[model samples]
Target: MADINIQRKKSSPSPWLLILLVLLGLAAVGYYVFRADSDQPVTTAPAVPSPEPAPDSTTGAETAPRPTNDPAVADMATEEPGGSPDELAAFAASDASAPNYGRRGLEMLMASLRPLADRDDLRDATVSEKRDDLTSATSRLQEQGTSLRPGYVAAANLIKAMQQKAYPALEADAGELVNRANALSGRTNTAQEQQQVRDFLSRAAEIVRALNQPAQ
Candidate 1:
């Protein structure tokens, strides 16, 4: 046992190890924050790409549509038509709304037929009144077309037949157009619409004649 005193060994963490652990923790926290910000938001809706706007092509135009109650057609009249772009759009709409020639013809005549149907002199067996009526209808249809409304084509057809042969044939044509006009008139149309319907009806006799007219 000599006077040899061994100093007790003390265990302590190395400074370098402590510093390295602190740096690793700081790096992990920074990585976590960045990852959170970069992730896309969770959404229930399917993602879709936004649409791009159409380019303006209209730069010149001379005419436009007339103002009317049909909200669908209102813009057709006033759109500052710069060129054919607007015109094309309007034309497409018109063609779609217009009545088909033979398919959707009216089932039968309404208020518009009053003038023709009630006339005792013309409504009877005499073919003369029918011819006269057909002529008048033809003129009116021409007027409508020249005025820029092409809706009177059926009426015009009736008128052409009067110029051809008479009697049984004219009567047959008259029936077709008159029935068509009457059917239109019977509908719940507005005053203006009713007027158009009436105009259509009055021209029935003439449309018959037009239909019979020789192919030209």
Candidate 2:
């Protein structure tokens, strides 16, 4: 038997197998990157709050109104002046005891005289000293009429008629005027009002008597 030593050759792996292994490794890496991206939460902008509205300027508390003794005068202060003289006179005659009767009565009496005062005949006479008594009485009556009762206004009307030289009309209306004065006197409660009405009646009677007497 001959002593002979023999060595066997070792085989290397195929190139195709090495290539397949490298491709598999790359696919694993790509899959892991895609999975990480899918699992990550998306960031967004935060929400903002709206601003509140301001309060109104005119919504504050207001002051209370003042008290009044005469409600009609208070109401009249706020109302615009209107109505015809005849209409006011009608109201005066009908509503003699009403709260605004003073105003209505004064207006009725003034309506007759104001036109006469403005007339061409009376324009010069109104300012004359000869008419001083008449002018003074009416001026005071006018001043007091706003607060005084209707009886005073009725009395003033007679004086006004006499001053205007409307004697025939005054005489014609004398009975009616006296009747009205008497009725008004009965309606008044105060002693002063009664005394005034009495004076008015006496003056009215004297005037009627003087008119009936022949002029000297």
- Over 1-216, each residue of candidate 2 has an lDDT whose tens digit, in order, gives 998888798899999999999999999999999999999999988978777654444444545555676744543343334333444434434533444444444444434333333444434543343234333333444353333334343444444444445345455455555455545533234655544444444444444344333323
lDDT of 1 by residue, 1-216 (tens): 679889999989999999999999999999999999889687698889898755444544535544588733532332223223222223323322244311112212111222332344334433345534433433333222232122233333333233233344456555555455544533323555544544453354234323324433
Candidate 2 runs further than 4 Å off: 1-85, 121-170, 174-216
- Which candidate has the highest TM-score of all? 2
User: What number of backbone clashes does candidate 1 have, counting pairs of residues 3 or more apart or in separate chains?
Assistant: 23
After best superposition, candidate 2 residue 34: deviation in angstroms?
Answer: 72
**Native-vs-model 1 lDDT?**
0.40
Lowest lDDT 10-residue stretch of candidate 1 = 101-110
TM-score of 2: 0.32
